[model samples]
Target: MKKKIVLAYSGGLDTSVLLSWIKETYDAEVIAFCANIGQDDELKGLNAKAKKTGALKIYVDDLQEEFAKDFIFPMMQAGAIYEGQYFLGTSIARPLIAKRMVEIAKAEGATAIGHGATGKGNDQVRFELTTAALAPDLEIIAPWRDERFRTQFPGRAEMIAYCEEKKIPIQASAKKPFSMDRNLLHISYEAGILEDPWFNAGDVKYRDYFTTLSVFPEDAPDKAEYVVLDFDKGNCVAVNSKPMNPLQVMKALNKLGGKHGVGRVDMVENRFVGMKSRGVYETPGGAILHFAHRQIESLTMDREVMHLRDSLIPEYAKLVYNGFWYAPERLALQALVTESQKNVSGTVRVKLYKGGIHAAGRQSQFSLYNPHIATMEADPTKAYNQDDATGFIHLNGLRLRVNSQVNGPANIGG
Candidate 1:
C-alpha cells in the first residue's frame, strides 16, 4: 500500500506545484486539505484544482465560525499582539489550520502531514509545532526544506516555468512583487519587493496593489464615522447596537473600518525562525475590536488586575507568535486572561477618521470610574477625603526621603 500524506494545500502557485510534486516524488497518494477561515473567493474552485494537481481527495472545511469564536476571540481577550504592533493574524491562524489538518490526517490514516511553508519562514515552525503538540507520531514533510526541491525550483521564475511545463494552472507570475496570506481577520503581505525594508509601499504605483482591505489614509473620505461595539466578557458581541455573532460582528466592523482606512500596519518584526522580516498588514476589523475591547476593559477591569495582565502581554504575545498555542504556558496565561475578563461587558463608541481610531465613549454596568470622587469641583457627596492626602503623601515618600539623605542628596546634576 502506498503511503498517505495529507498536504495543507491552498491551491496557489507553490501548493499547486507541491501537490503534484509530492505525489510523483514520494510515490504516495496526496490528500489536500484547505481550511476556509475567511479566505473569501480564494476557496472557490479549489476542489477541481486539487484533483487536477494530483490530490486523491480534497477536504474543504468551512471553519469561519470556529475560527472567529474559538481562535480569534480568545486571543483578543488575552490582547495578544506580536511585537506590540502586529495583531498576530497569520500566527494565530496556523495552529487552527494544523489542528484541523491533523484530525483529517488521522481520519484518513495518513502517515504524514505536509505543508508548503518555506524553511526560512515562521509558518514552518507554526505548522510543525502544532502537529507535534497534537500528534507527535506523525511525520511532517516540508518540501521547501528538501535539497532536491530547492535545487529544482530555487526561485519564483523556476516555479512558474515548472508550472508551465507541467501544464498546471497558476495565478502567480514572476512580475508579482509580493506574497499574501489572508483570513477573516486580516490580509498580510510580505517577501518579494517587501524584502527591501526601505521600500515605500505608499508610492503611487505600489499603493493600490499592496492594500486590499483598506483604502490609504490619504484617500479615505473626509467624514469621520462612529461605531459602537458591544462586548460580553471581552468578546465583541454586537456592532452599532445590533446583536451579532462573532462572524457577523467581524464582517460588519471590517466593512466600517475598511471605509475609514482603520487598520494598516507596516513593521519589521523578529520571526520565530530567528530572522527579522518586514510585514504589511491590513486588519481593519481587528484594529477596531482591539481598541474597543481595551476601552471597555479600562472601564470595568480592576487596576491591579489590568496591570498584571498588561505586564504579561509581551510574554503572551510571544507564545502566540512563536507557535506555542497548544503549549501549557499559553494555556495558563489564557486562564488568567479569562478571569480578568469576567466583568468586561460593555459598549465602546469610537470615531474613525482617515486610518485613525479614537475613543468616543465607553460605559459598563460594572464600571469602576467614579465621577464624584474624581471631580475637580467641590465634592458635594464628600466621596473622597482631601485632607488625608498629606499623611498619605508623606508616608509614601518616606523611602525616597531616607534614600536622598543617605545618598547625599542623590548628586543633583552629574
Candidate 2:
C-alpha cells in the first residue's frame, strides 16, 4: 500500500510534469485538485489532462463565488494595493487555493502535498507559507526547489522534453516572454520580454497585451455613468440601494468597468526576493470598488482615522505580497483598519466613462460633514470665533518671532 499525496494541479506544463515526478520520487498515490476561480472556459478537459498525467483522482472545485466573496472582496474593502499599482491578483489567490489543498489532503488522509510553483517566483512563498499555517504536519514536495529534480531539468525546454518523453499532452512548451495568471479579479503578466523596463507599452511586440478603449460597450455612448456603492463596517453591500452578494457585486462591476477600460497598470515593483520586476495588470472590477470605497470613507471616517488607515496601506500590501495573509501582524492591522470603518456606512456615487472613473457624489447617515461649521457665510452667532485665530497664530509663531528678533541685525542686513 502506497502513501497518498494531494497535489495542486493546474493542468499546465509544470504541474503535469510534477505529477509524474512526485510519483516516481516518493512512490505515492497522487490526487489532483484544481480550484476553478472564474477561469471562464480554461477549465475544459482538465480532468482528462490530469488523469492522463498519472493522477489517480481529480477534484475540480467551483471556487469562483468563494474566491470573490472570501478573498477579493475583503481586500477591496480595505482598498488594498501593492505599491500603488498591483491589485495583488495572483498574490491574493494563493491562500484560497492552499486552503483547499489542505482540506483535500486531510480528507484523502494524504501525508504529503505537492505544488508546481517555481523557485524564482512569489507564488512559491505564497503557497508553502499557507500550507505551513494550515497543516504543518503534512509534508510539502516542491520539485523546483529540489536540486536533484532541478538538475534533471535546466529550463522550460528540458521540462517540455521530459513531458514529451512521458507522452504528456501539453499546451505550450517554450516559455512565452511574459508569464500570466488569469482569474476573475485580474490578469497579471511578468518576466520574460517584459523584463526590459524601457519597452513602450504600445510596442508592436506587446501591443496585444495592452487594453484599449475602442472596444467599449455601445450603451456607454462615450459618457460617464454614475452608480452608488454602499459600505458597512468595511464591506460593500449595495449598489444604488439594491442589495448584492459580494461575488455578484464584483461580476456586475467588472462588466461595467471593463467596457470603459478602467483599471490597467504597468509598473516595476520590488519583489520580496530582492529583485525588481516589471508587470502589467488589468483590474476592471477592483478599480470601481476602490474608488467607491474611498469616497464613502471620506464622508464618514474621521480625519485622523483615515490617515491612520491610509498609513498602513503600504505595510498591508507588503504582507499580502510576501504571503502573510494568515499572519498575526496582518490580522491585527485588519482588525484596526476594519474597526475604523464602523461608522463608514454610506453610499458613494461614481461616474465611469471611457478610461476615466471618479467619484461624483457621496452621502451617509453617519456623515461628519457639518454644513454650519464649514460654511463661509457670515453669522453673528458663530460657532467658530474669528478672534481665536489671532491668538492661535501668535502663540504658535512666538518662538519663530523671538529667534528672528535676536538674530535680525546680524543676519538680516548681511
Cα deviation of 332, candidate 1, in Å: 0.7
Which ranges of candidate 1 are over 4 A from the true structure? 411-414
**CA-only RMSD, every prediction:** 1.4, 3.3
Please give each candidate's TM-score: 0.97, 0.90
For residues 1-414, could you state the per-residue lDDT of candidate 1 as single tens digits?
Answer: 999999999999989989888998999999999999988989999999898778999999999899899989999998878888999999999999999999999999999999999988999999999999999999999999999999998877888888888888887644667889999999999988899999987665776776688888888899999999999999999899999999898889889899888889999999888889999999999999999999999999999999999999999999989999999999999999999999999899999999999999999999999888889988888878999999999999999999988886766685
Model 2 lDDT tens row, 1-414: 898999988888888888989988989899999989877777899999988999999999999889888888778767789988898988999999999999999998898888888777888889888989899898988999999899988788888889889999897645676777778888777777778898765444554565532222332357677878888876788877789888888877777788877777779998887788898777788888888888888889899988988898889888889999988998898888768888988788888886578878888899999777777887545878889999999999998889889876335553
Candidate 2: Cα lDDT at 42: 72
TM-score of 1: 0.97
- RMSD, candidate 1, Å: 1.4
Candidate 2, RMSD to the unseen true structure: 3.3
- TM-score between candidate 2 and the true structure: 0.90
